[model samples]
Target: MSIEVSNESGMDVSEEDLISVARFAIARMNVHPAAELSMVLVDLDTMADLHVRWMDLPGPTDVMSFPMDELEPGGRPDSPMPGPAMLGDIVLCPAFAATQAKKAGHSLAHELALLTVHGVLHLLGFDHAEPDEEKEMFELQNSLLAEWLELRRQARREAQLAERDRRLLGKAGFFDA
Candidate 1:
């Protein structure tokens, strides 16, 4: 998938991690491999303007999704053949998300990951406007985030082990300098 991320928030954030999480979410949702996605991290003022103009809200929101195409989960036997698509744009306000992260008792990175997944879901036509919809969407969002985080943890553990093995081999003169 072609996932592009641009940080215009004026704050130091991990662009790499955001890309990773977005790719994972899109793949998990069975989006086409050729699907393209764009994520923008904007400052509070920009977010507030978008919120007011698009949603008619008063203040900045954590994230906002503007879907480009009507896309559904593909790769199923009954589903249509997967093909290229422009998923949409996800605008995130990190300055706004920081407050939410504080209340949620998690790191900013974690909160951003969750928001990224949430934005993906919205792009795929998921909304929480009603009670039932909210439950289904939240459940899926939480599940996806949790699974992705676990995968990251597993990768870190594997990397650590690999490094340790390499160091041990070097110490024992098993590896050529």
Candidate 2:
């Protein structure tokens, strides 16, 4: 998957993490490996403009998704043959998300990650307008985020252990080359 993230929010945000989460979400949803996604981190003013123009809302929102192609979750026995696609764009406002992060008692990075997953779901035709729809979408979104986080944690642990082993070997002159 080609996940491109552009941070134009004027705030220091982790573009790398955003891309990683997007890739994880798309892969988990069984999107084609050649599918392309774009994420933009915009400032409050830009988000506000987009919200007003697109959603007709008054203020800047946490995230907004503009899906291009109609794509359903692939890889099932009866699903369509997976192929390259333009997944669409996810616009995120870091400044607005910061307030939500404060209320949610989590780091800004975590909030962004959640929003990214939410955006991905929307791109894949998931909406939370109704109660049942909201429940299902939120459940899926939360699970995807949790699974991605756990995977990241496992990777970190493995890297830390590898580093520790390397250090120990170097100290014992076992890695001399």
Per-residue lDDT for 19-47 in model 1, tens only?
99999999998888988999999999999
In candidate 1 the C-alpha lDDT for residue 74 amounts to: 65
Residue 90, candidate 2: Cα error in Å is: 0.1
| Per-candidate clash tally | 0, 0
Screening candidate 1 with a backbone cut-off below 3 angstroms (N, C-alpha, C), the clashing residue pairs are none
Candidate 2 per-residue C-alpha lDDT over 1-177 given as tens digits, one digit per residue, 9 for 90 to 100: 888888999999989899999999999998878889999999999999999999999989999999988778863345465664688999999999999999999999999999999999999999999999999999999999999999999999999999999999999999788
What TM-score, computed on C-alpha atoms, does each candidate reach? 0.95, 0.94
Q: Candidate 2, which segments miss by more than 4 Å at Cα?
A: 75-84
